[model samples]
Target: MEKIFYYFLIDVPRAMTIWAVLMVLAAAATVGLIMRPRHSGTGTADLAAEPGGPGPDGATPVGAEPALRAEEQRRRALASRALELHRYAEEVTVAAERSAVTAQRRRDEWLTAQEEAESAWQAYEAADVAARRVAAAAVLPEPRTPRTPAEYADRERYLHRAAMAACTRKELSVLQLSDALAHRNGWDPRRHPVEQEIVLRRTVRDSLFAAHRAATERERAAWRDAEVAAEAARSLREEAFAATAKAEEFRRWLPSSPSAGSTDGTAGGANGRVRPAVRWRAARAG
Candidate 1:
């Protein structure tokens, strides 16, 4: 048993020495990995010497930082310009909206004004039509004439008579009659003497004729009324005479005799005219 233990101890020391040697190798590998630079596919010495690599002089080449800074500044300026353009677009959009709103308002106001004007025009047209209708219905006035000494008295007399006649008759308009007389007389008496004289004579003649016709019509109406009254009176007289004749004939033809054995005997007159007793009683009572 002691010999077996001694051999086992000697084997344990040998195993421990091998384990220590492997630990030392692992620590050396770890240190070498930490010191080595990471590389994709290039050699370490080539990567370090390259101008674009991370060496003291290669990290910042001549004019590299200044070029990058200038590029950064340009990018910043472009971004600022883009921001300003966006702001201007917003303002333009706002201004355009306001302008559009104002234009629309103006258009609406104009349309409203046009509508009002149209309404007013329609009203004016209606009024004008009404005025025209009135003018058409009314009698037109006569033109006035200048008076001359030669025809003034005759003209005055004619006018006075016409006015008086027009006043008497409701059918004739005074304005119309006066206007007609004035037109006939002529406005320029000196220039149109013959025409004025002729017109005046014609007007007088017309007035006289009208008056005569009116008088004749009145006389005719009176005659017709008288004829109708006479006819009616003749008819009444004829009816009265016929009634009287009928009454006399009836009195003469009435039977006066009662039949035999009647208590009330009919009386016979001396001339053979028979009278009934009832009729005699009635006459006496009356």
Candidate 2:
């Protein structure tokens, strides 16, 4: 009975040892199984929970996202500004072209006006020359000699009276009246009246009468009116001359411009400092 009891005790110790070894192996296996991922889902869940990992929320870091967005926005703004600048440049180019066209048109108009003014002046100069030539041709020759002393005396008396009357009118100067009368008779004073003794007396009487009449009878208003008419006629002539001159100047300066038309003063009229009626009569006589 003692041996049997001993054997049982030994078997019991071996069994307890085996049981402890099994328990240790089972605990290690339980820990490994609990820590292991079921599939890749648990790993993906863990990545999602962490920042800057493979999940959607973790793809970009929290601090870096704003910086990336700011960079993108800045690039877009730059592109927009570039487009606006290009459009502005095009507008400026168009405006410049329009300005150039307008300026050219204005220049063309100025050139045309200049040309017109030049042509009118040339016509006036030609007319003026012709009129002067006509006046020179109308002068009359002096009479040769008187038939008798009585005839000479009568002629001298008539000339003296006419000169005095002309002087009284104040239209002719002394020199002009003397020249007219001298030319009508003879230029020589010695042969003027055929009787030299009475010549001085007749001349003195005529001069006194002329002076008296001029001092009393001459009207200021009439003279002024005559002068105004003369001035108007002269102004017309001057204007024509100016137009001609301007045309010449234009030709000299800008040959490509337009031509000017004829002006009014080119034709002759009563332009002298004389009464209109007298001028008209004189013109007719010429």
The digit string of per-residue lDDT tens for model 2 on 1-286 reads: 9999999999999999999999999999999999986675777687776654546544655766677566545444443343344344444444444544554555555455445434333333433454445445445343576578776677667656655664665434578567756754323333443332233334434444454444333333334444555455455444444444443343233212111211211111233111111111100100
Off by over 4 Å in 2: 1-58, 137-286
- Model 1, span 1-286: residue lDDT tens: 9999999999999999999999999999999999998676566567566654555434655535676556545444443343344344444444444544554555555555555555544544543454455445335453466666756666555555544564455323465466654644333323333343344344444544454455555555555555555454455445444444443444455433322322224444554434434332111100
Q: Single out the weakest 10-residue window by summed lDDT for candidate 1.
A: 277-286
Clashing pairs in 2: 115-257, 115-258, 116-258, 116-259, 116-260, 118-247, 121-244
For this target, which candidate reaches the highest TM-score against the unseen true structure? 1
Report lDDT (CA) for all predictions. 0.49, 0.47
TM-score versus the correct structure, for each prediction: 0.32, 0.28
